[model samples]
Target: MHVLVLGAAAGGGFPQWNCNCPNCHRARRGSVHHWPRTQSSIALSADGKRWLLCNASPDIRAQLHANPALWPSELRGSGIHGVLLVDAQIDHVTGLLSLREGCPLDVWCTPNVHSDLTSGFPLFPMLDHWGGLRWQPIELSDERTVTEFAIPFLTDISLTAFALHSNAPPYSPRRGTPSCGDNLGLFIVNRQTGQSLCYAPGLGQPTPLAMRFLAAADVVMVDGTLWTDDEMQTLGVGSATGQQMGHLALDGPNGMMALLDPLPKRTRRIVTHINNTNPILDDQSQAASALKAARIDIAYDGMQLTL
Candidate 1:
């Protein structure tokens, strides 16, 4: 399986337009240590030809422009077979609009997220006027059971969805009840090679349920939204901690780093959906070094891995 890091920054991206925080400022001033990143999203391919998008981030157009593999052919066909949404956040779903240039699209998500998109945000009605859009509901089950779904032309791949703690989107009518399928995580397994991967860019917690899923995969990419719980407040970016914003911090005794430390050494662990205010973006920072020593990776746009 081939995985592409289309974009690595959270909602607003690195050096967010309205943000003048230290990190964003450094990136704007072209500081070598502070490179810019687009909002979070990833692309996965089983045969290296047809691909499935993890999330259609707002930066999808730019991200696609930078990736030649995702470019359309002369016959006007896109390599993207479908999109799997983990949630219905604006940053995650807005890019679907950009894809409405006449091609049919298949979108897979949980029922609540599907409802939020069709009703709360009403994306389906608008996009339908442009082209065909199929909304498929993914079934969630226990970590031990692999919920199955098939990607067109990738018969050798099996896709599954797992329940995650959903803080729900701010616009969601169904808030607080994670069991409503407001959020989810995906596990992609190669039926041919037996290699598998897990992706959860919208995690609220690395619960035991999440851990069980991670344990079964060879690669796990999860939320890396903040460095510490109070990072946004200290940086004057926002009043909410990472947890409050439906993310897990990278540091602290109860943080994702410590929680993920016990995973098998062979399991490749990486972090994504990072906020612009996090200091870990700086390669020279102690936080980055600590993560490296702990065998964890900080994702960057355009990075790729073969699992």
Candidate 2:
């Protein structure tokens, strides 16, 4: 399985156009230590000809341009076989609009995420006027049973949706009940190779279920939203800590470091969906040193890993 990192930054991306935070400032100035990134997304290929996109990030156009493998000669109309959405967030699904009109793209997503897209945005209606799109809903259960779905041209891949704790509180509007639903972390395993990849971007912390998935993965690309809980707050970039923003803090107990320490040596761990404020983007930063020492990689745009 060949996996390509399309964009590694979290929502808003590194060096967000309007923000004047120190990290953004340094990125704009072209400082070597601070690497600029786009929104989070990834592409996976079994034969390296046909591709399956993990998420249709807002930066999909640029991401496709950077890696032509995603745009195969077989591309007609919309230009890809299918897209797998991890959640219903704007950053993940908004880029579906960029697909070519009149081309029906197969979009695989959970029921809640599909509902959110079909109702939350008017763009779906507008896009339908051009040409209707097909949605394949994947029903998720708390049990870690492997669900298999076939990608056109490519072989079937086993996907397991693991339940995760939402960052939002029970009273929070974002926290929908069982009838509506919460976000999910996806575990995709290539049937041909038996190699699996785990992705969980918007998570409050690593659940035992998540760890179980990670333990079985050949390549694990977990969220690296913030170095510390108060990283953004201390930097005066945001009022809420990283944990409060729906992601795990990278340090301290129940953090990324502690979770990763016990991971099997064969499991290749890489951090993705990184926030701009996180100093892990800086190679010289102590945070970066710690990650490297533990054999965990900080994902960057255009980075590719073969599992």
Candidate 3:
């Protein structure tokens, strides 16, 4: 299986249009320490010819254009064969609008996430007007037995999805009422090579269940949303902490770094879905340097992994 980092930044993406955060400022001025990224999303391909997009970020159009591997091969055909969604957040789901053209896409997500999109956001219903949006519902595991799924075209790739602790979308009826399928993390395995990968862009905590999934993967790509829990508050960006927003901060004793530092040395750890306010965007910052010292990578657009 092949994994491609189509976008690495969190919601508003690096160098968000309106804000003048230090990181964004430096990027706007062409700082070498910075490389602008699209919103979070990735594409997985077993054959390198057809891909299964993870999330449809608002920036999917530009992201696809930037990666030649995803470019269309025929007059009206595209390399993307299907889509898999991990949650119902705006940054992750809105790109379906841009993708409504051409053939209908086979979209996979938990039933609750599908409900949120169909009722709360109504993106699913809107897309249906043009026809061809196939909903593939998935379920969380009871833990006694593992649950897994596969994209027919990507036959060699199998994915095991486990519940992740995250808040439901504000517009969702289940908001503030945690449920099993609100969010999820995927453990992708290459059946042919026995290589595995874990992808979770939103993680509120390092729950035992999450750690189990992480322990089994050769590569771990997860949230790097905030430098500190208080980043947004201190930057005057917002009052909500990373925890409140269902993201794991990168600092603090209980932060992401602490959560991942003890993983097996051979695992390839990567940071993605990073908030623009995070100082790690500056390669020279202590935050970025810390990641470097640990041999953890900061994901960038177009980064690829062949498993």
Candidate 4:
């Protein structure tokens, strides 16, 4: 299994155009210690030729440009074989609009996510505009369901979607609707290699089932939205704590640091969907050192790993 980190920063991305927070400030200045990243998204390939994108980030064009192997000149209008969405967030699904010009694509997502995509963005009308495009909705269940799927040019792969708790409050059906189910996570296994990847980007809190999946995986790319609960408040950036923002805080007792400490050393763990305010964005910062000591990688935009 070859995994490519398309865009590793959280929602607004590092050095978010309008923000002047410390981390963003340093990133704009091109400080060696501060690395710039794009919004969160990834691609997985069973063989190097064909790939399946995990999420279609708003930065899809640039991400594809950065990784030419995935979108060579001859494959430009052909499009990827499939796209799997992790949530209904704007950053994750908005990029689907860009795919309209390419070959009709296959989109695999939860029913909730599909609903969100279909109803939320009237401007895109992706589902209706692209005749060749298809939406394959995966109904998440408490018990895992395994199925075989193919990513063009790659080996057949096994996919599993499991129900997990949503950190966000329920969206009012009366007011408006949500595009994706509030609860979701994905476990993708490569049938040929027996290697697997567990991805949960908008993780609220770790549940027993989530932990079990994390424990069993060879590579775990979980959320790393904030370094501390009071991060935004302390920095005068926002009123909510990290938890209140719907992501796991990395510091303090029972935080990400504590929860991830017990995982077997062999398992490769990485933190993606990182926030702009997180000090770990500054490689020389203590937070970065702490995470490195724990063997947790802070994701970067062009990072790639072969399992």
Local distance difference test, candidate 3: 0.90
Question: What is the clash count of model 2?
Answer: 0
Residue 3's lDDT within candidate 4 is: 85
Per residue, candidate 4 scores C-alpha lDDT tens digits across 241-260 of 77655678888887888888
TM-score per model over all chains:
0.96, 0.90, 0.98, 0.90
Which structure is stronger by TM-score: 1 or 2?
1
How well does candidate 1 match the true structure in TM-score terms?
A: 0.96
Top candidate on lDDT is 3
lDDT, residue 225, model 3: 90
Evaluate model 1: give its lDDT.
0.86
Candidate 3: misplaced stretches above 4 Å?
none
Determine the C-alpha RMSD for candidate 1 after optimal superposition of all C-alphas: 1.4
User: Among these predicted structures, which one has the highest TM-score?
Assistant: 3
Q: Relative to the unseen true structure, what is the C-alpha lDDT of residue 127 in candidate 3, on a scale of 0 to 100? A: 86
lDDT per residue (tens digit) for residues 42-132 in model 1: 9999777788888899999899999999988767867788888889999998999989984478888888888888888988878988885
